[model samples]
Target chain A: MRKTLLAAALVATSFGAQASAPGGSGCGWGNMLFEGSNGMPMHLLATLVNGTSGNRTFGITSGTNGCDTSGALSYNGENMLAQAGVMEEVAQDMAMGDGEALTALSVSMGIPAEERAHFKKTMHENFNTIFPSEDVTAEEVMGNIQTVMNKDKQLASLS
Target chain B: MKSINLALILVLASAPLWARATNEELAEHPRWKALLHINEGTTWRYQGRSYIDDPEFFLHESGATDARAELEASIEQLRPAESEARCDFPARYRFLSQQLDWPDDGALSHCSDYQEWREAMPEERVALIFPASYLNSPSSMFGHTLLRIDRGNDEDGVWLSRAINFGATVQGQENSILYIYRGLFGGYPGYFSNVPYMNKIRDYAHLENRDMWEYQLNLTQGEREWLLAHLWELEDIEFDYLFLDENCSFRLLELIHLARPDSTLMDDFRFAEVPANTVRSLDRAGFIESVDYRPSKANELDALVDRLSASEQDLALALARDASVAEEEAFQALAPRSRNLVARAAYAHLRLQNREGERSQEVAQRGLALLRVVNRTPTVPDIDPQRPVSPEKGHGTKMLAAGGGMLGDRGFGELQARFSYHDWLDNPEGYLNGAAIEAFNARIRRTEGDDLTLEQLDVVNIKSLAPRNRFRKPVSWFVNGGLDRRFIGSKRHLTRHVQGGPGLAWEMGPVIPYAYAMARAENNSAHDVLVSTAAGARAGVLWYAESFQLGLEAEGLYYHNDDRRYRPSATLNVPVGRNHALRARIERDGGPDRAETEFHLSWRYYFD
Candidate 1:
């Protein structure tokens, strides 16, 4: 398929240069050659082969393309907040104490999966400060999050 | 050039080429051919000789004859930093550079203008938005979808973000039926357009009284960048619009496919796309990170009204209707939250009902005082509801039914099937309970003699019965045009049917009920194909729990020259599993000449 070729050529050309930064050496560029980008042909073919199995391709294709998971964070200030809308919802979730926004917020805060229970409690307790009744703006929330992030060792490095 | 050479070798190795290929032919080279669907003149083979509608988007120096030249011209514009670039070129450049392995030109310096706009914006977030069905409108039955490009603002931006909507660019004078027919049959040009989220909020929430659901997407910035740029490529390009397979929902699925090429979101939807089902595909792909519910103004008003005691509601109603209620003891005795809640409801009710100017200045002034008192308590009444179940958890659109039954005196085996959508009489869990959009449903039965006959068929049947509460008084409506066999004149009759109109519907705490006034037409085979037109009224009720659904429908019509009749039907359904159900239906359609009764039952299966 065209996308596979393009991905191949892209890897051929950008591999050496990308290895140093966000495109970690062990990441997906090498895998794309074997799997061929999940191009339209393979996608269609997989659908035909799977035939009503329910959730056929995502289990295999997800995070396999080096872009979604196990991918190094971008240094371009295009952090999770800039790239995906999750962090925005995450802020609201911290206030609500639950939902997709919370999951996104947790990931953005770099909290380990196991520690999220305590992290969630901390978030719930700090909801008032995060969304203070006083002067609140984007800067204030960011500053508040920064303060919270610094207090926790894991999130401290991110701050 | 090396990449081009590699592409050239690949193309040559794969297939023989015409000697001295035309520029058009060169555009069909493997590398270029893959993108041909995005080009103007490229043939899509099966979509009925359709061509992209915008010529300027495809024009090259050679009078648009050379697609390769046009692509090069287009790519040249993408080579600059976004701010320096013209026409949001980064959208194009980002995609091409990533996929084509174009050489990186160092870190992109922020396009000052774009950066400034972004800085003023919230974080970048994408949500696949669905405005639940509003029955009075046929086009909204399967519901409609748009992408909300949330600028990462909190709750506020979900209502203020940019929305990408793909819809037909109809000019004028076309009636609803004409519009529906053309929309389903590719008789219009579809365009992708953007507008502020507030505009959509006003349209879907305030004006339409439809609640919206926003499913959060967890796409990375790279994916978002590709999506944004692909939208740029499609900015001016137009595709022939066909509601069945290439409507708003289908186009949105294509956008997602472009973003996450690894996912096949458009497969089951190749023939027809249900907006809700398309969303379900996104969820299945594991792309949906979360869901957010946006209550319409009416929903808010209803929630507020519910909090008030009936007497308080009456006081608020009086205050909203006239300016003399501030002195009433009932109004004066309420607590701040209750006063604020009632005042807010009253004000919203007046505006929503389009009677804002009727509330006197005295009333308005009193309402404002109550609002000011209400605001003193923390924040504006925040009653954001918990997210609803995702539609994917609902029964699949396509269904198959098989069982044995009796018609008249003979025993029979039957099989029935339906395409696209849901019906209130079907499983009600995980779907808009009262909304149904079914098309091309057909049933066939074989009697003891093994004689096959068409029992009944519906060409298209769409219904939206969003229940109006005291806060929201939405009009319910339906349109069904198809063939059906009913007992008329003491015998079975198959007639061509067409009917639609407006009605009132409400969720009366325990049950959802609706009524309609419709104009109907039918071609009766029993009457030698004589066309019959009539004005009719219908009423129905639907009672549903997670595993059970029951519905009753009754209708009466007066035909031309005083012919009159009434038809009533009842149905009950029990969901068998995620993909199966059992249903029983009974009906008695009475006419001036005759009244006939029938009962039927079947077990159903579903496919995605």
Candidate 2:
């Protein structure tokens, strides 16, 4: 039952996006999110669609604090998988935006010591913008992050 | 009409002021009920209960009195702009916003860090991976399933991806009996764990002598996203782990349902989710595209061992036994192929010994040294082994038999049925040949008196007759307990039989023959037996083909009443499509009832 509600929610959210878009409520959710012609901001709907469950609503089956908002720790496969030990676990942790992994990732990206924590905080705050979807690769994430860094002057200053 | 409508609207608006709907009323709300999966006996989504485990997360408003108030308060908290950013249930709010067509307020910001992580682990494709059963582990012998998130193409990249596994988190110090009892009765909680695909391969392929079958699924990007979202929600959540119903395979069915919401994958497996049956369900749903077989360490070791001559095998065994002496004498002088084969076998033997905990610390250290030397020069034997058939292609788990034939000059009809799962004589197309497990099997027959009597009823019978290979030396055995009608001194009586013993089975080309020396205990009114005990020896041979199956078994029993009996049975089966088959059987029992011979034929249909 809870499963269907979320599915229904997805359907409705897409529809709402369509309504407010240029077609003004006539368009469906798909059109509202993708048509670009709609005045509705794309990032808002995109982020809203993917990032909500991160909060405490982790669902009835899911316990609270389901989302890993922290940056990656050293255990989060900061290095390649050629090495053993926790490489496998790190693969999953890094994929989940684990705080340790995110922080480790920022440190690896050459973020200064002072700015690494802030960088991890920013990454946690804007995980959707950094990841966008499942298809987004590591390179794509880096590219989008550059854009995010370039567009936000504060982020640029930290870098 | 407008005035009446206005009055009704006013009443509805004022309804929440003081005379708010009771918790039950709130629970019955269509959306609320749907959200909680509340039915007639709705208490909690998860069957497991505890005081510390918050009921608010699972219980319906009707079940938890304060739930309605808490829910209402949480919903109201979303109204204010400041609180909107930290909305309690962002997912729920988004869902409700769309479900109610309410505009979603820009609240939860972009989880850029999560995106970065997801970007690192992009899921382009997905597959259901079943690590096919390993012998000796009854819990996993039927196998276990996991979801694999694919990154690159179907080739080398599969190992680099992550696998999501769901399994019961058994408590430490839980004995096997307690584990089985708890597992069967929902005493354990199942959790989802993730690890690299390579790690899974190392565990299944190298550590556990279990072959794996990966069924690549066809799912779109959107569907994959939904699956990921659902998996995220289930992370760290404990399901009332049931060995049968909400098992590992069953939980995966629910996860897959989220991907294709319209598909009813979970509906078919409400009672039990046999891993093989679940694979069939996924196949029926047109979700599986291709299947890849991952050979286990034992598989590879056996394949290499098969190509070796007796002398070569002896040499390999000797080297494994004492690497120091054998290496000095025979290891340095051998053909490259022989060298490769011997090295691989020795490595496998050492690893197996270490894994099974038969090797001492010093021996294991020496074995590791041997492995390092073996690894230094990677050798590939020329011979390749055939891959084991995938479980998805196996015959249906449920079987029903109904037919009529003659027994002891009496024209008697009989009906037999088995709910599950497999038998040695059953078709081995998709299952491991010679392995059989059947539960709740019954055969009923009608005599000339027109009275229907149960001829035989079996509760549980399991036999794993995987013929010992060079890699695995399994002691094939059988355990069966049931009631059967046996003849003694020209009279027939129902006898309850419980028998089990170790045996040996060999698979030689088209025929698989086996022999067993079992200790049988029988209880019957007619048999004035010593302590109601008996002993038995049995021998059987089976020749199975795609279109036809032939089996014969001869058994000799000595009862406590100083009675001797022998029964020789022969049977054949011709499959009718994938789910149906025609079977015929003939049995001659040399009892006091004049050495009677019985014949029967049955047309059976199988269902998922």
Candidate 3:
């Protein structure tokens, strides 16, 4: 009788803590509009709403973003969480998109350190361990260069 | 008086027979035999046609009829002129200068008895017939050389003589051709006269007359002249459809021996009965030209012609000409054709495809054709249509690893040069052999609760030995040699220096396969030289479709100073890309005082 009463009291406390968290709105994707320096408070609120989201995804604040359609995180941040098993399918989809985007980024910024590592790891996991790459072609490399140069120009225009 | 007359008659009767015997003896002399052989070998003969225009007329009487009367009448009625060209059996020729004349005139000249004119014709009249075509063509019979047949001897048969026939013609009248005029006074048979008549036509025009057989040997001037000098004495030489019909077996053999001594006469003649011993000698010598005065006459002329002409002679001639044109089309094709008979013979040996009877038959036919072309025209090179193909991609190397298993890290490197010329080239007249090399290393390391043991070993072999690399198994000083050096140092181990001895390798394929030996040396003590002999085999397959290479090789070595020790190993390798490779290798080794086994894997990146 005493154990049951204590469990009921613990659950009520957890519910009360969730209800008091920031953003009563649904996952608060609009909160991602806040600048990188803002440290989006929505992720903390969302982590409470979705109990399985881990610290790698929820505690990142504005440093990294997840690949969720909710637009609160970037592909890199999502892939990291996926690798950690916080989000498996979501991380894989983000990695595929990241591979396509990184091809362009590689030509512009010589490949982001995080993206290069993630892509290499993915290749190792899929193909024969003898090589990390098998389908590199001249056409694909040129396409990447064009996209990266275009992206750089757009960013420069804004600047 | 009666007795004296009878004795004189007896002496006269015996004189002619004695002379005949002496003549026969002279003809059989060894010097004559040599001369005859040379003469027979060089002369060119052809069975071309001679054009003879038959004019329907009788000669006029020289004295019975009034010459002035006939001269006036003949001059009024007849005009001299030439006719158009006519086709002969082999080529076109023309004749010129058929004319009429009268010596005396009388009122009854026109009424002169034709019988009297015929009776007087044996003395002074002759017919001059002119042909009408092929007047200025290069192939016309005006500029070539011709031989005249001499008249019959006291006997009915005619003995061939070194005689030049009538001269060739020059620029004649606007519409007239030249011809030899046979007059009644000349007393030459018209049939015999025609033969030399056409021959003289080409001779004076400075063109090469086809031999009596009407086939051009296609020889260079010097060779043609040499052959011509020999051809005259050769007897009973016959031809069908412009080729040396195999019927001239003995002569054909002689020709082959002269032109290509290294050729395998028997192998080429498998379709016929070429003597076993003769073929064996030819194979050993690597050329037919080296053999002289063999039993060539043992095979009759009839049998040879029967065999070579067994197939259509016309077809063979066409094929031979086609092959010649194909050969002349390229300079690269011309080199092998000019090589010595021995080299050609070795090439033929390599070409014999014993796998299928069909290929062997084809090779035999090509060999025969080559023999014939060389025999007739020794200076013209013969080309083999088959040439080995070169590989497009370079070599491959690889390394493999499986953690915590009986196998350790293994590394292997392979270089293969591959091609499909033998298989892909159409109707190839020959084949080419490929070459390759493989080097492998095996390493095994074991740690029992932190105490570590390590070993490294390697075996190297090559397909076509390169002059650059110095590390290999040199099994014999006279056969092979190599040198290698290595240094190793570890945090918990002492520095070690290792210098490997030379290694030996054997390659037995098309270019060079299973026919090599090598030995290497190492130092046992300060003053001792220890030697080791290793025997090994290596084979590889190149997947051009995937641009991948795989190889398997095994090698074993035994030390002379230490008989109890034997080292044996195997290696496998695969290529990853142009600059990278993966390898796997394993080895079982033993020594005089200890034994060890190891496996190794390696990933090699090459800068060049």
Candidate 4:
């Protein structure tokens, strides 16, 4: 079973296929949010060898954020977090109220430098709302973040 | 009409001679050789082969072994105005077009795919990224190096940058033993991959808990573009991956050398290429414009814990264990700032604990509860981890030593050499603390009236003594296998042995103490059995200071053959400079039948 999964993964890597959301738009930001928890053993093996077991990416789909073309969260028509696969870091940084990952996220979201502190504080206060369940998908988190920002008086304008 | 035909014939006949002279001259150029991946050799025929393993990388039938033939074939293949071969090998086209003064009538300028890739990667600068060594992992013991393509605009930070990495593309599921064997013997096909910088940060800093050093290079804009075009040419090209010399570091140096042909970065390394040694080469070649440090999540957590008081630390631990502690008065009694620190520590601790584990709902809820407390309280200042000395400042990897000492009653002179890596007694400036990894180390001794003989040859020795603290519990372990000269009854004979085990270590002030339960299997000429196995225990204490290091160790082994042996040793090492040190050792080996005392002092010199 593991070998079959690895073969599938190798195919995906060769074709540069994105891990798109299930039953959703082709935004590619759905189930991969919680992927950090799975694949522990394989991940360790890859780390041990200093090699990627078919986890290669070319940054072509990564730097272009997401497929949300009509949203304020999209910066320069790109969704930075869509292919980031950094939901774990984003969650931890949100809890800490500030971190490199969180700061980078905000910067890519078109949040100005002066208003980043308010953005962090608001995210810190609503951490549970954004990440209500352990199995929360990245799509749900993105929606929750948009909802939270829409309600905040200071950050509402930016959202 | 006849006169015009004769003129055309004369022009065509003369054009062949002129172009042939230029083609021959260009084929022999140094840049062409670099592009073909040719090595310096004694003769032209011997030096013509390229290091690239894949046959598809060459345009000619015998291009892998014949550079001149490959050049001619490439020129012939690229003569058409609109050919797909130009897209496949854009860098070659660029080089040839300039050399041959090709017409600018759009003959060789059509590479839409290459142009799109170039536009996708807006790289104006390049940096060498070195993820520091993680002792727990075998392949990363010497660390790994990759290249980062940075844009001139610093709006997105480096998280959005692209990284060029070269590594073995492992196929199927292989066991650890097979993996190591194949990795060292070039059984795997290696490829160059481009990935987002954030993915690597997630892998190294967060997942593996290893810090990273970035050495920004000083290449011009044109050079950067040249390197990028070359990277595109190797999109799916395969190179045989050998873990030692022809590995990631070696390939990266090749790319950098191709960019700046005058730099001598690839001159010193031929046999083995340690990543740190490559960084040193870059520095020596003046390719480094600046250095940056990125601390790992573990390092950040340590720095955070360092700022907390003892009581606060207990409170944080309690909060991490039970979320209800946040509602109790024990947590509420502290100042708001203190509460923030405690809550932050709790969340960080829980996250780190779950780094390698499956996420649990209970732990996630508890983490959220701690974050609630942090959000309610005043925000505390951020913690910045203190940076250690850069890796280039460390001592060289190869070591050579000469000394004289006493073996039992005879005076002996000894010489020792190691092919690569650090030992426990060496300087600890840019290496992992309390870790020793050595390979291919040998020591030879000459007694007063005896011939020179090898005293010991350690094929591979690795020891990681992670001192446990309140926040982390790491297993200290060691494995050593090699041949040693041992006294069997009355004669000395070379014996083969392997010994290792797991143990515990503790950090106290400036000293770290550790103990291990060891098991050994040995083959000796003096033993009655074919192989004698032993179970034993070893304990040691190491004291580290600014200028010197001291270690005291003792071990006892009981063989299945009814033989018992005990050894107690002490060693002192004083580092004189970055590449020089003095070391002295004294040991007493005793058994039920015989006892011997030996001492040695040596001056060590290190080089790449």
Best-matching candidate per DockQ? 4
DockQ values for all predictions?
0.02, 0.02, 0.00, 0.11
Q: Residue B392, candidate 4: how far off, in angstroms?
A: 2.1
Model 1 achieves a DockQ score of: 0.02
Supply the global lDDT for candidate 3.
0.25
The 10-residue segment of model 4 chain B with minimum total lDDT is B39-48
lDDT of 4: 0.73
lDDT of 1 by residue, B1-608 (tens): 99999998998886533434544554444323223233222122233111354564453454244556755665566655442443444444554555445566642445554444344333388888887643344334356788878757362235435667776544423443444456555566766765545446655665556677888899888777667655555655766666555667767766776676666553342555667677777888889998877766666677767777877778777766763465577766777567656666666666566622233555434434443333333234365544455556777878999977655456778899987556767776566667776766888888788568777776566676767754556677666756676666676666666667777888866589888898877766565435677898999888876568888999998888576788898988888888898888877776878876667788999887
Clash numbers, per candidate? 5, 30, 97, 3
Model 4 chain A: weakest 10-residue lDDT segment is A15-24
TM-scores for candidates 1 onward, in order:
0.66, 0.69, 0.21, 0.85
Model 4 clash count equals 3
Docking class of 3: incorrect
Residue B444 displacement in candidate 4 (angstroms): 0.8
Q: Return the lDDT, model 2, position B104.
A: 54
Give every collision pair in model 4: A65-A79, A65-A80, A66-A79
True contacts kept of 2: 0.00
Each prediction's fraction of true contacts recovered: 0.00, 0.00, 0.00, 0.11
Candidate 2, residue B473: the lDDT equals: 66
